[model samples]
Target chain A: MRILEYIALMAVPAVVLFAGVVMLFGGKNYFESFIKGAKEGFATAVGLLPTLVALLAAISMLRASGAIEFISSVLKEPLSALGIPSEIIPLLLTRPFSGSASSALFSDLIGNIGPDSFASLCAAVIMGSSDTVVYIISIYFSSVNIKKTRYAFPLAFVVMLFCIFFSCFICRIWFK
Target chain B: MLGKIFGIICIVSVFFGIACGNTGQLGSAVIDGASSAVTLTLALLGMMCLWSGILNVLKEAGAIKKLTVLMTPILKFFFPDAYKSGVGSEEIAANVAANLLGVGNAATPLALSAMKKLQLQNPTPEIASRDMITLAVLNTSSVSLIPSTVITLLRSSGSENPFDIIIPIWITSFTCAAMALILCRALGSATRVRTIRSKDYKSLKTQARQ
Candidate 1:
């Protein structure tokens, strides 16, 4: 199973590269177009620099200050009353805002709890299933300089909660 | 909006760290986090440049047009405003294709391009159109044929079967997207059922300029 996963990982880039070569043969101004696109990409990365700094700094501060841990513990009791495990709360909260942070936390959870455990599996599901909502909204909306996001922010968050609920609920049923 | 939220969170965290007697740790974390953000941005730059370059080859060859044709109907339904803008749908098609592959980095450039195109048609230049909101919804709750990142993490953790979560993630992705779409349709002013025609959009574009 792991072998197949590794193969798929290796294959995506290969396929893309192959397609890229095909395009070079079939297209006009290949190198010029690539440079043009690369220039655009470079600009985008530079443009997102400020937004990334702010979001990551805030996240790091919260993580370091123990606020996330504090909040998770506080939410645990109330969540348990509703049949949700407190162990997965941090992962749920972190999953939507930053991918690297969530990935770190997820690997940590699997290490502490054991991989075969239901909690670990649930963590995997939630992490895989949701995008970093706040990051996406902040970067994309700000990139186009659209100050009025209208329903985008609230709608993304609402969808995020639903992903968490369904990830845990379905994990419970499937792993049980 | 996010700036304000991040501000409140950071200030609260600063006070909380002081209260928790971890002022030194918090200070270091902030610096470390800021540096890592730069590192991540650098990493993004590499991937973005590579994919954008490669995809540009395909794009210049007009290969994306085939995908655009295939995706036109579905994209047209979800992004009516984008379709009205004509060229915006091309970007939308590329964005959606990258998204379904679970390559968020690859998708970001396309998504941003699509957003800019959609913004051009927006009645209010500063506000997102219906299509913009839907694109965000789609990107956030995107379906993936292979969630390579998640699987890699689980592998590092020594999961007996990391791939086991595939079906569950698929189910979760579908539901998240479905619910997001329904919510956007129900709660968004975008869904007031006001179909903004291209003629009206053009006139509004002029008005917006004025």
Candidate 2:
């Protein structure tokens, strides 16, 4: 099983390299395209600066203001009553909009709690199945100048709730 | 500013609630939690800026375009409306790719760009067309495969098997994606029918002229 997992991991890179090689053989212009692609990728990285700053600042404020903890406590009972672990609340809450922040929180969780624990598993699943709703909706809709997105926010919240609940439910069945 | 105001109100409310409830520990917990959150959030912002900047560079260099080409077929199936306008398709693909890679920080700008392009193609700004809504749904319910940050957190927390959650993660993500897709389709069809009916009513007078 471990070997299979290793193979799976290796496969992604192997395929990427193979494609790169194939492109190289396709024509001399392949190099130009590759360079151009890389350059564009770099530009995309730069273009994300302001949003990152805002997200970071917001996250900081939320944390500093005790808003996250407050929300966490508010959510604790319902989540725990549902058989969801308390430790995962932070990761689950943050995962949707700020990937990096969520990852950091995930790391902190794993560090504070044992990784093989139920809390860790639940956090991982929640992160995988959900997205950052507010960030995506605000940025996407605002960019397009769409003033009304009646369905987007509600749908995002529903999806996140479903993901958390479903992941917890399934994990209980599979792991236990 | 609004967020700050809301935060303060929340804090004050919590403090009073704790005092009234005679939960002494609650106050301390809130303080500690808030301070830690602020610190962590600051760190996260720095990381986001750095990462986003790099992603921006990638976009400028055309890597995003290359990625769009790579993911074109899937995007076409998922976002047929976007494909009608070359720009929409490209931007949508880029945004989706960024999300998939666990780069929400990078995905925001791309999503914005895609929305802009999508808006141009869709003149009726009042209503979100079928394709637009579908894309919105998919974007909102992005399926994350690795949950890299979560795994790292688990490992840090002294978990013996951080990646053990992979199977469960995959199961949940696939399920959510399937369900979201179905719901979006159903809602889209219903909305389309309503829009058509409205159009028919508006053209009722013209039908007599014809």
Can you give the DockQ of every candidate in the order shown? 0.42, 0.25
Candidate 1 ranges beyond 4 A from true positions = A1-70, B1-70, B188-210
Candidate 2 CAPRI category = acceptable
Report the C-alpha displacement of residue A118, candidate 1, in angstroms. 1.9
Off by over 4 Å in 2: A1-4, A7-83, A86-113, B1-13, B20-67, B85-87, B103-105, B196-210
Q: What range of 10 consecutive residues in model 2 chain B has the weakest lDDT sum?
A: B46-55
lDDT, candidates in the order shown = 0.71, 0.61
Q: Candidate 1 lDDT, tens digit per residue, A88-158?
A: 77667657776655654565567567877877887877877788888888888888888878778888988
lDDT of 2 by residue, B147-180 (tens): 5544444544456655566667767887887777
What DockQ score does model 2 reach against the true complex? 0.25
Worst 10 residues of 1 chain B by lDDT: B190-199
- Which DockQ value does candidate 1 get? 0.42
